[model samples]
Target: MISQDVGTRAISVQNVTKQFGFFNALSNISLDVAPGRFVSLLGPSGCGKTTLMRIIAGLDRQSTGRVVIAGKDLSLTPPHRRPVGLVFQRYALFPHMTVSQNVGFALSLQRVEKKKAANRIGELLEMVQLSAFADRPIDQLSGGQAQRVALARALAAGPPVLLLDEPMSALDLKLRQAMQLELRQLQRSIGATFLFVTHDQDEAMVMSDEIVLMNSGTIVQRGSPEEVYRQPRTLFSAKFLGEANIFTGSLRREGNKSLLQSDVVNVRFDVLGARDTGAGLVCVRPESITIEGASKEMFVGTEPNSVAGQVREAIFQGAFRRYLVQVGEQSIMVQQPVLAGTGDAFSQGDQVLLKWSDQAVAQIEDDTNG
Candidate 1:
């Protein structure tokens, strides 16, 4: 099990806010990251995730609030004085310096002896698995190699906190996956607190121990990957993490069970005895839906949770077949694995039943207007 108590908190942000004239970039943001933990700030563009990160790194000042790192108040500390390292989206390496010199640049600035800095650089290069490239120039390395160099450089000063801002955004899909695994392992071995910023949900889900999701200058949700994915509290979060079909309806409670009622359908949903107010939204993942046979006997005694719709379009997607079905004027998407004859089984205009268990539905706050 991962240790929650890492002696002391690595970083803390309380009531953090940033503004530029009439625009508020961040608003009342607060969070705590345990020492040696990997936490990610995830959001779309213009969400202030970058602004929050910059605040923590002391590169940008907050309009109001306190930022503490390693138990020291950083309100008056400049970026250079803080025990933090920042890796940018671009590699930001010196074109003229070799890999070893680049990683040792920070140590050199601190007036460390040249021999000791060289020894530390050698060790860091080995830690990042780039020892063989120590003598190579920055222009001679691949994108992934350059990223490793940047990481080694950031860690050279042994900072207690490491901040990465979209470090892998420029790599290809395969290379990005490879680097994610490498970076996670590296973090474990070094035991440094990491605060990563990313717009990609998949990247955050794969690498973060806890994810802080932000939108429009405020935090929307913060939790583990599974917790956030399984129980999205807001409509924006449900749709932002992945593709989801949302249905707005009223919820009725009868004794221990609850039922959701809408104009097109009424579905029984599982909820833990908690009272649901008037109108709410139900979110269903595409992969959770199953298409049943067209025969009436197939759904003979099924309850109101199931719906029958006609297929409007079907396309083979290598591993799975994607089908678009029309229920009234709304379109619902269903995905199923493609077997040898599965594609031929369903055609346009064919009737199919879309079935899902009540436990698969997640209720979210309806925030369509705001």
Candidate 2:
């Protein structure tokens, strides 16, 4: 792990592992989150994201490694004693309590005076924009409203860090998306480090300042949304984060350029330059490919990165059309924005030329499973 400045990090996890009998749930997990930043722990099911969050929250202990929050190691601290707040997917607000009561729960536990707790609850409800509903029963609140109350309760103690475990998964898509924005705004406004955990790629991308992508109990990649999405470092990262058109090939360097001979696609690809090519895997996003109707003379040119193909399928989304172009044994996807003269768009059985630039294609390193 790189040496970190103690003052900058709100949470630091170093070489943490959690094992259940012979099964390793987490393997040498190390991550550093800066103060007041929204960082998402993202991965598929059983990837150890929740396990890691539990460890950080002190609900579950790691087999090894140190967990530090706000410059103090919390490895030995109990959940309630730790300087972190937690919100879960199912918040499980007390059905017997009112919204104000729930928001003041932590303050009451801390033995704050009744007047002080009431004032704090009032401030929290105002912050969450639920002051009007402070007296409502928990059983009567909507899913979104309950989540807001849960968030207010978590924030009542003003912990330096907040850990959310798929907090919006219970809401519908529209409400979930709206909550993503609201949660992000709340974190920024409160200036607290938020460690959000989710398996949804779009939610992570929309909410996180940095994404810690996990797979098979290990960190696959960590970066800003654009960096990890557009410049993935591994095959797992490329495929998991978004849609990727993958091609396996043998790489050969020719002077300043590199060419790949694909055994699967039965074609050659020109790459921008040489790279470590023990087993070449290239990834291009569907949106990067441009498709136009192929002419008889189009294949005659010596274009470096063009594929002569025929449209095998086309799907029209609201703003764009998705076309599957068959070039030799490979079928490539191309997405183009809908333009004027919709009747002139490429359709199935239409001959087309597919092309993309060197910058549009990225090389991915094969993972253990690949």
Candidate 3:
């Protein structure tokens, strides 16, 4: 991990809006990335993550707002004049060039000395662990190797900021997973600010120092992966980053606590204030709920944080057992870790009680219509 100074920003985007015809691709988006930090622009496809990256890279101009890269305002600068490197999804490498030639293309454009360019290419190939295949043609390399070549080419100019737009989407699952770690390590070692754009939640979680979640060209939430996952502020943020079981009801105040009453489930949790006292929605993660066998007598007057439900479906995934329990009119998903050499704990058609702590449930806004 790279330590970052919050006092300084490597890339600052202020109130940027990109308009195409009448369709607003990005709407008043603003972001600040610290030096040596890895930030991910995470969202679904067509959510304007790519448009934001293009605007930062100067490939597409923002309709309004300023773009400052490495402390210089470059809103109207051309792509080549910006102090940022770009890695596209398709790589766009020269098929006729070798790995060394591709990695040194930017250096050659600057008219650097031949020996200096060769040394820089050697260093980059070694950094990406492709020194052994430096002479291989672009078409002869594997998907992972090609991606590394593109990364090396992007970093050839030693730009202060690097913009990667789904550079690993073409690789297989296993290779992509492996490269996620590799790319993270590369960013840490190089200490350059990286802005990665991906729709993959897992990818963003594994690699980013911070996650900026966007929806409909607007930022939904921005925080660390664990913070966003554990404390989502809205329904979209809750459901998009991970699986969540939402409980909705009318909210009422009880001293310093808040109680949500519903026919299906009632939740009583501590609240910081009275701002949220109307329509209440709470999100609980599947792994946070515990399941145990229960009888009809145990569910007479249901208590807060406890619910009795029948197991409708039980799946034996390798690492955990996923159970879909039918409670009232809703079905809640619960995951239990599968201990090695232990048999299944609960089977289908069994009665079970699910319980979770109030701290495990996050209060989220009902932004379904937003």
lDDT of 3 by residue, 231-326 (tens): 999999999998999988889887777788766777777796534567778889999999988996666227888899999999989889999999
Report how far residue 101 has shifted in candidate 2, in Å.
0.5
Instruction: Give all candidates' CA lDDT scores.
Output: 0.86, 0.86, 0.91
> Which pairs of residues have clashing backbones in candidate 1?
none
Q: Residue by residue across 183-215, what tens digits does model 2's lDDT show?
A: 989998999999999999999999989999999
Index of the highest-TM-score prediction: 3
Global local distance difference test of model 3: 0.91
Worst 10 residues of 3 by lDDT: 1-10
User: Which residue pairs clash within candidate 3?
Assistant: none
lDDT of 1 by residue, 126-214 (tens): 99999999999999999999999999999999999999999999999999999999999999999999999999999999999999999
Per-model TM-score, in order, reads 0.92, 0.93, 0.96
Better of 1 and 3 by TM-score: 3
RMSD after Cα superposition, model 2: 2.6
Clashing residue pairs in candidate 2 (N, C-alpha, C atoms within 3 angstroms): none
Q: Which stretches of candidate 3 lie over 4 Å from their true place?
A: 1-7, 341-343
Clashes of each: 0, 0, 0
